[model samples]
Target: MTPHMSRKTRIAGISLAAAALVAAGITAGTAGASTVQAPTADGSPLKLSASHRAELLRDASATKAQTAKELGLGSQEKLVVKDVIKDADGTTHTRYDRTYAGLPVLGGDMVVHTAKGGAIKSTTKSTKKSVKVASLTAKIAPAAAAQSAQGTVAKSLSAKKADAQAPKKVVWAASGTPVLAYDTVVKGVKKDGTPSRMHVITDADSGKKIFQYDDIRTGKGESEFSGSVDLGTSKEGSGFTLTDADRGGHKTLNLGNSESGEGKAFTDEDDKWGTGKPDDPQTAAVDAHYGAAETWDYYKKVQGRNGIKGDGKGATSRVHYGKNYVNAFWDDDCFCMSYGDGEGDKAPLTALDVAAHEMSHGVTAATANLTYSGESGGLNEGTSDIFGTSVEFYAKNDKDPGDYLIGEKININGDGKPLRYMDKPSRDGQSKDFWDSSTGGLDPHYSSGVANHFFYLLSEGSGPKEIGGVKYDSPTKDDKKVEGIGRDKAEKIWFKALTEYMTSNTDYKAAREATVKAATDLYKAGSPEVKGVEAAWDGVAVK
Candidate 1:
């Protein structure tokens, strides 16, 4: 379908009306009754009580003083702090795009303190407590409400299917998020006999939404009666941008070896990233859909997690973003997916495994929430690659034959060479073949080599093998033939270690311990799964 006529397009249409309501007085800006001014990522703005201001100020000044003294006695470096005061009306939170997430970002509270006097004390951060809206009750404008209600009533009064395509039948969608509004081929008129549009209302914070819209808006001659409906307006003047808001779900990009793409792709006119092409919506949709579906099925059937999170939720994909943008990535805030057209639109990164790989990062973020810096970072990257490959193996499609190379299909090197090689991560020269003190210092994409090799050995065993006609030889660091615990179990152990144990600063050694602990927790300390995990790491020389 064309972008202007898409299902989401219609639902988003009503957002204008919703924005109009904001203009009156129906704004959700009230931060419950005065919330504390602690530094939290809660989307709402912070409001400190009169009594709390002194402590907050003192602490802020103290923290600043300490930081200033650390630098030197005479310092031009200064951190300006704010103390916002509101009238009877509450203040709106300052919403910005999440630096990492693509959605609107909101934050509250920056209490600074000084040393002995007005120097510096400490710093703190916390999100605002949720606005405890006990229940959502609204007196929609009488005219608008009546018009809305009357449309439904009117639809019922004159409900009839178009006399085409075999009358009419009701079919409620059972999966995926419902769009705001759409045009059905032969949906015909509403019950009131008036033609209407369909749309859904989604939660501003989370993308969850419920279906609600005018079913009929008709006027005969001069009698434009909308079921005695009334409309209520707002006082916010106009539309209010949504904060911490997202429109859809994003999946991952699973690669041949199941490596995740980690870089900027394309940028939108608004400076946002995307995957869809400039004008080829249908082909882009098909390519992205098939790739995503293959990935979705891969994780479900192989890992048996039901879906990405073992929760059956589908991953979202965006393709052909910007004019010849290069690269793809996964961010925690998105918890979804995106793609890009390589330089000059030569390649589409929405390949099945690539999409799966990217989406798995989200699963990782939700589960292990691995920090993307050092060893854990590499493991995190490798984890995405591993699953990206696993999802591919599970998909078993034709266009993409199975292989153990990362970015083999994407043409990263422009010579048909894969981006990274798991069997010998150093095959790319940029990645490591074994763990070392400096391994943790390399980029995660390169540092990921050590674990990628471990997974290769553990899944296929350190030797030549054939799966779908592709030959792979996973070599070990010390020529020690180590046994694998199987890909299925290894993936599970890695997942558990990440989601249940890993933290932002976790490094290689810590990762080893965490994985061991996860293996022990999943399958007794000395069980086959645990043993295999140990052997895999050992094969990579991390033992």
Candidate 2:
């Protein structure tokens, strides 16, 4: 294998093959309409002051109808409450889904902000346009649209393993105009039995392929420091199964060393399973289960997010996929994460960071819904890496102390080397440490280096340093030194930017702006955190 290059399948997230399908959105600069005291630098829980009670109470009284009117959703449109989040300072961010004429409106989701006392603040929307459709009727037959979508997938795959289901009709507001469209999922096994999953949306009126995305994200993940963790198991008729009933019924399935098959649910006489070896399927399951559990805990405890979709639902995990497949992927269609055994089944890609990486993709989809191609795609991938690394640190497992090096444990290249480096991404040869116009032409994984570098610089600062017993040497394009803001504050800033300020089509420049705004919201406009954000972006040549 080439040094600093990965030969293993490295599919990490949903790949939006077509860029036009991304939701058009209005970018909100920051989220500080109602001022609240900033979080402590020590990462303590935010405490709302009693002084803000009046504002909080007033904002809490704002109804959905009022919110709809504030957002300019016409009478034909309806706002459905998805979630309501109250911060430590009694600030609220109410998320909602939109429907037009009783049909689901794609890209019409938005979040309404208000002060403690129900004083309407500002609105953040995936799309600024009103949800109004010209017609609900479809001229093209569903079958014809499915067939057309299949033809589009057949151009790349020889095997026919399309999802055996009918397509659903929905309004596609990704473009300026809302059009009735048919959404189809096509899947097939390649000559090597590797699977390909793609989502195809066709215009119902014209039968033209409107948008398509690849769901088979390939990559390898694993590590030894994760140690052991408690897993929630379900009791079957006579034994216990590897199903986490407490975490939205998340189950881990064994693929029996093949690429296809429903396989079997792992069960044992006692819940204490796995011998820490690939020879035992339960070993991988143990790691997978532990990783999923820890990831869920991290989001819930730290970010106050419920599950991957923030809907208190869990996605399944499949291990031992294929014959030494050397890759892992997350399938949104099935709402499951699948992992392959490394060469000779000696290594399973069930590491902690890998598990978090895959699950974080689902979170990105639910929140920013970032397009998985071009600059937006790079941000999407980088966002996963940031959260994945964050989850690793949050776990605080002796076996795997948090570090910025990605895939360090799995050694996908078989050379005992990490898959990617955040401190100096250019060390990977394929990844660029700084941004440039040509970045959009690179693969999302490689293009993601810019953001990864920025995050590292922001969290740890530029130049040589040691963190968590790991040594790192980070340099800047401008040859400038940056002071660290600490990971806790940095992650909070990034997460706020991603969830509140960013949109589906956010690029590198926009990401810089969003992070600056996020820092300002959390630490004030001229605080050190905001300055750190600007310095990190400048170090990455993103300005």
Candidate 2 C-alpha lDDT tens digits along 287-365: 7777788788878767766678666678898988887566677767678877777666667777777778788778777
Q: lDDT for every model?
A: 0.43, 0.70
Count the clashes in each prediction: 104, 20
lDDT (C-alpha) at residue 37 in model 1: 24
| lDDT minimum window of 10 residues, candidate 2 | 18-27
lDDT of 2: 0.70
For candidate 1, the per-residue lDDT at 484 reads: 60
Displacement of the residue 404 alpha carbon in candidate 1, Å: 1.3
Each candidate structure's TM-score, on Cα atoms with residue i matched to residue i, is 0.49, 0.80
Error of 2 at 399 (Å): 3.0
